[model samples]
Every structure is written in C-alpha cells, then in structure tokens.
Target: MQMNEEKDSPAARTVAALVARARAAQQVAEGYDQQRVDELVAAAGWAIMEPARNRALAELAVADTGIGNVDDKVRKNHRKTLGLLRDLQGARSVGVIHEDADKGITEIARPVGVVCAVTPSTNPAATPANKIINALKGSNAVIVAPSPKGWSTCAQLIAHIHAQFDRIGAPRDLVQCLPAPVDKASTHELMRQCDLVVATGSQANVRAAYTCGTPAFGVGAGNVASIVDETADAELAAERIVLSKTFDNATSCSSENSLVAVASAAEPLLAALCARGAWLLGAARKAELAQLMWPEGRLSPAVIGQSATRIAEKMAAREGAGRPEWQAIATARPSMLIVEEDDFGEDHPYSGEKLSPVIALYRVADFAQAADTVRQLYAYQGAGHSVGLHSARPERALALGLRLPVSRVILNQPHCIATGGSFDNGLPFSLSMGCGTWGGNNFSDNLNYRHYLNVTRVSQPIPEQVPSEREIFGSFFDKYGTA
Candidate 1:
C-alpha cells in the first residue's frame, strides 16, 4: 500500500501508527506459550504491586481527576491488581485449556490480537493495570484509550507497564496508549482499527465500541439497589453499606445507590446507618440536598465523587447557589447521605445511580415489595447490572436472585466490593463488569483473561453414535402414536 500521510487527520494518524505498531507486536505475542504469557502478567502485576509505585499512581489519579481519596485509591490499585493475578493462577491460556476424550474434541486458547481497551476516569490506575494484565495474560497486545480526564494518570500507569516490559525484554509496542491530549476522534479511530475493543467507560464510549464494526466487550450501566429484609442484621448491613458507598467517594459504579427496606427494619436500619456515620436528610431538607446533587435534572459534576462533608458545605453555603433555609445536622459529618425515597419510577431522580455517597431509602411493606421496587429502579437506569440483598432466610435471597434481572445479585455483602470480586467471594476478579444484554452488553460475568482470548475447537475421528429416528421421536410418538 502507498502512503497518504498528509490526508489523515491528527487523530487518525495517531491511531493508525499506534494500531500498526500494536499489530506488529501482536504477531510476536501470538506465538507465546502459557509460561511466557504468565511471566509477562507477573512482571506487570508485581511492578504495580510495589507500595511506592502504587502510592504514586494513586496520588496522580486523585490529583488529575479531582475525585476520590488518595489513600483509598492506593488500596484499590493494590488489592484489585493483586486479586486478579491470584484468580488467574494456573488458568491456562496456552494450547488445550480443555480436552474431552469422550466427545473427541479439544479446545485451545489463542490471543485476540491488537485490543483497543478503553479505560474510565473513576478508577484510572486500577482499571488500566487490570486490563493490561488480562490482555498480556491472554498473549494479546493492547492499546489503552483512557478518558481525557484520566489521561495524565493513565499515561503514568502505562509508562510503568512499559518499564516492566523493558525489564522482561517484551515488545514495548505490545502496550500502547492514545497521546497526551485524548478526544472522541482519537478514541473512535482506535476502536475501529483494532481486532477487539474492550471499553470500560461511559455509555457513549460503549455504544461507540458496538458501532465500530469490531468485536467488543463493553461495560453496562449500574444503578445498584440494596434490599434489606426484616430478618437481616440491621447493624451489620449498615456497616457494609457505609464502607462500600463511601469508599473512594463512591467511584465504583457498583456502589449501593438505593435501599429498599421493610418498615420493621427501616427504623433500625436508619439508626444503624446513622451510627455508622450516615447523615439522614429529613423530608424538610430534601429539597436543599436535591438542589445541590441534581441541579437541573442532572448530577452535579462538583458533587460526584466528592466527600460528604464537602457536599454538606455546598448545601450550607450562605452566598452561592443552593442557599437553603436549613443546614444539615452540623455535627453529622457523614460518609454517606440518606434520603427518604418518594418513588422508584423515572419521575423520581434519587431512584437512579447518584455516583456519589447518596443513598435513597424506600420503606416497602415487605420483601416482595422491595424486590419489585428494585426491579423498577433498574428499569429506569441500571437494568441488568447488580443489586444487593440482605436476608437471614436463604430462600428469600434466592427468590430475589432468580427474579431480578441484575447479573450480580450480591448477597449479605457490600455491593461495591462483592459485585466486582473480593477475596471473600468465588467470582473471578475483574474491574470490567458486563451487565448482560438487559444492560446493553454482551456478557454477564466479570471480565477476565478468558474474555480476551479466542478459543479454537479441534475434532478427531470417532465411532458414530447417531440416534435413530425411533429413539429421537419416542416421546412424541408416545404422546400421539406415530403421526
């Protein structure tokens, strides 16, 4: 092919060069065996696991994004990367991951080359590192496309990964990213040229991935709801909810957004949440909080991922916008805000995900009403995502799990931590959560190495065991006597 360099736009040129390099590197990566692939993953994970390295990236992310606590981001960077490495141990991505002698077939793993991996601003460091490890583990070359807001921090993380590649003498082209100034044009161009796209950002980015005419794995929306049955432990539930909701200032999409509870447990739940540093906003003060949180029917960017104390200040300010007659309980420097829910339909704003430490509470008559309300909440925003249920009775939890459309029905645990994966749960560790078709995604499980690899099935000759027509139609024949 002849070169036509001047005709290409800046974004197009940048993406084309990146993709060309990635494709060349991918050809090299495709030949790696399981041991070499795992070695690359280990080097990347270990480099990110260093405390000093973790602290620097975490600090950079919080400083650049203007969201999340530094300490919490540090912990997230370590734990999420460490957990994913542990989960994939001994998981073969080389030849013959599975062999079935009985069926005379064998399944082998192959790399999905030149992945265009889109990362989000919320968990910039962790999300990119996690995706990088999974891509390398599957022997796939990745080109990271970070959100503009997360570019600097994400670039730093990628630089760190490149250093690891240098240490191991791996191809630097195997790990690439969009340039310093990222935009929609660059991201779309990257998505179009790659063999596979793994997007983990806003709905727009995910939609772009599907529209780019490339094989893709993208994240789904999440307005995570939690239902507290009367039989649940009120205090323990409150503690877990607070821990998850306030972690990194509600950066995770899986953080609990609403609480549907029975009247019997509502009072105790409220009291327990209060004890655990949740500031309950009475009906009288609801308008003020609403004015600050959902100004003009959209979540205020200033409040999203901000501390609860800062939000209270925004509400109590005397001069600027949202000047209210009453200030919140001044002594209550809560980690999360609790609002009494009025409705669950689209008519109500609080029913959807707030992306901050605000949780809406719905007092239903019973557990059935709670599940129904949760379903309605998902219909409005987070359909096919995740929900948390706390109950002493196993059947009640199981019943809701069976009934809800949510892919991850978190049980008696913090939705933020459990929905993704934790040491306590059996789910494979990952940052990209697929919300299934209901949430406008293709997969319903936590994204991992297997998702990044292509599977090839081989068939061998065997004795035929075809079923006779008589045997195949026995049930039909028994019912209608040989039509």
Candidate 2:
C-alpha cells in the first residue's frame, strides 16, 4: 500500500499480500532442513557484522525516536542479544525432535507458520530482536507491527536483519515487518490471517489480538509495587530501589511504581535514601512533583527524560506564585518519593504506573500490612506482571511470594533488573512480562522461545497380557499391605 493511503483504503489488501508471501515462505521452510534454522541463528551471532548491527540499532533508535539516549539503548540491545543467544544455544526444536523408547512414538516440532508480532516503543530494538530470534528458534516466520513512535527504528532494525539473512544465504522472508503503519483495520486483517499473534504493548493492542480468535501470547500493564520490611537493611534496600527506578529512567514495566515499607523501618529507610541521593518530598513538595509528572492531570512529555534541575525549573515557572522554595536539590534525582499512610486504596491515583522515575511510598503497620498494601496496589493494576521484596527474613519473603498475585516476585534485588534478567528466576530475560492469573494470561512468565513452541506427549499402551489374580495380590500385598 502507498504510505499516504488512508486506513480504510486497501490496507487489508496490502496485509493480505504480505500474508500470502509469508505463507509461501512457510511452505519453503517446511521443505528445508530444520537444522538450517539453528545454523542461521548461530551464524548471525558469530557474524562480524553483529556489532555493527548493534551500533546501527542504537544510533537509529535515538536519532529516529528522540526518546531515550543512545548509549543506554546500545547497552539494552547488546545485553538482550547476548542473553538470548546464551539462553537458547543447544536447545532443540525440529521434526521428530523427541522420542520415547518405551512409548514407541516420537514428538515432532512443527512451525506455527506465520506470526503477527506487535511491539512497544519503550524498547523497540530489543523487543523486535527478541521476537525474531525466538520465532526463528521455533521455526516460525514473523511479521512485526511496531508502534508508530518506534517504526523508523524498527525499520532500520529489519534492514539489519535482512542484511544478516543475505550474508547467510537464508530466506529473506523468514522474518519481515509491516512496511507501513498498521491501524485497527490493518492490524485486524493481519491477526485474522496469521497463524499466531504475539503482542506486547498497550491494552488496546492486546485486547485486539485476543479478539482476533488466534492463539496469542501477550503481556498486560505493570504498576510494580515492592515491599521492604523492618528486617531489611536500609542501605541495601535504598541502593536497589535507586538502581531500579533510575535504570532507563524507569521506562521498564518491572520498575517499582511504589514502595510499601514497615512503619518502624520507614524513617530509617528514608534517612538511608536521602544519604543515597533520594529526595524525600514533604506534603507541599510532593504535590509539586505530582503536578510536574501529571500537568493538568495528564502525563507531561517534557518531563519524561529531563534532569532534576529541568523538572524543578518547569514546576517553579508553572506554579509562579511563590519563591519556588523547591529548588532542585542534589539529593533529588529525577525520581520522586512520597511517604503516605497505608489506608489509601487502589483508587488512589498514586498507585497507578508512572513510566517516568516517579515512586510512591506507603508506611504499613507491619509485614502483614505491607503485603496488604502491595495487594491494594496490585488491584489497581493487577499482577503488575511482577513484584519485589527486601527482607532478611526468609519467612517474610516467602510469605509475600505466596500471598501476592503477581507472576514473578523479585527478592532482595531491584525489581526492574531482577525480574527480567535473574538467572535463578528461570524467566527469559525480556522487557515485556506476561501477567498470569492476576494479569489474565495463561502463563505467569515472559513470552520467549519456549512459548513459541508447543509440546506433544507420546504415549503407548502396555502389552495386553493380564496378570494372574495370585500374582496381582502378591505384588499388591508385597508393596503395600502385608500378606
């Protein structure tokens, strides 16, 4: 379709053409050796051009999007690539891939044909790379629909992938992205024709994917809330919170949206946080920060990545009625903290997820109350897809894990970093996490390579020889009841 075409003007026809190409490519893939999939992935990793690809993605992401910084996006892309490669190496996904000698049957790996994958703007390059690599591992072809805010960067990313495929003599159609912006109509058409749908973005996109009647893997919203009990080390907890909230300016879904601290530990934690550059806002100052985050009750784009000084200046100029007493203190990083009593329910606006470095603090009477407060926050944005805890008490940690509705509970570490990348968590490292029961997902983990593949159980009937009554009785009596 022409770039200038309206949403209703032949967008579906274009999508149909792309889907036809994808189906043709899938037929070709079915005949080619499955081992080629693995070879191509490995070659992409080892290719000298991989580093250049990384650099290109970083540059294009910052230049085209004008959202995040280049250096950090580079780090995110590199780490995600290295981590995905390490995790999927030697994993098998091929025809007749598993056999059971006793069952006299084999389980084969089948491709899902074509996947319509949607990605978000927060981590454009990382998310597409992840989806492409996983689809390759599972022998599925993918067509990406990136958010408009991220399309230019995503286009650059696709170009890089095509270059890699050409270098390896692989099918160019194995991975493809929508050449134009996808509106509701185009997205609906793509979803209906695709074999599977994988969406990671706004609620509207996820809902649309589910409504399309195709098998889907999706992630919902995350307003991650963390608990820090009295048993926790104040300094350590503060450090972890700082690291998580400041990481990528708190763009990650797993970043702590609020902190629930025990009343006894709250003061000490606040002290420790101040020592570590976290500015604790008093009632008036807290209100000012809130207004800065939500100017006239809406998110302010200007404040998203600006430094503390810039934010403070903007706030002061807007309020323009006083001495602007709240100058940007060195202790005040971009993130904000407010100490509030624990009776506030999910209706409290502070419980909502703020993508920028804004955090809410709640003081609970005890550990139980802290968990309860966290539950309230989760109810505001159920499951968060993840939660976090900081406590020396093993029982308390386990208690929170059992009681919280989130799929993943990060412990003793920064919620953002640990939830997505923890080796011990057994969750594939990704920016998007699928909220299970609480978040309405069938699975309580991030969608990854394994999710792209399905498992088949091969069962066999035992020989039809019937055991004699005496033998049966003897075996039962010998194993259980004494004869």
lDDT of each: 0.86, 0.74
lDDT of 2: 0.74
Query: Model 2: what TM-score?
Result: 0.87
Model 2 C-alpha lDDT per residue in residues 133-250, reported as the tens digit of each score: 8887877788888877788777777777777778878787877777767466777778877888999878889888888889988788878888889899999999999887877667
List TM-score per model, in order.
Answer: 0.95, 0.87
Error of 2 at 230 (Å): 1.3
lDDT of 1 by residue, 322-359 (tens): 34533445346778888998576556788888888888
The global Cα lDDT (0 to 1) of model 1 is 0.86
List candidate 1 stretches off by more than 4 Å. Answer: 1-7, 318-331, 469-482
Residue pairs in collision within model 2: none
- Per-residue error (Å), model 1, residue 470: 5.5
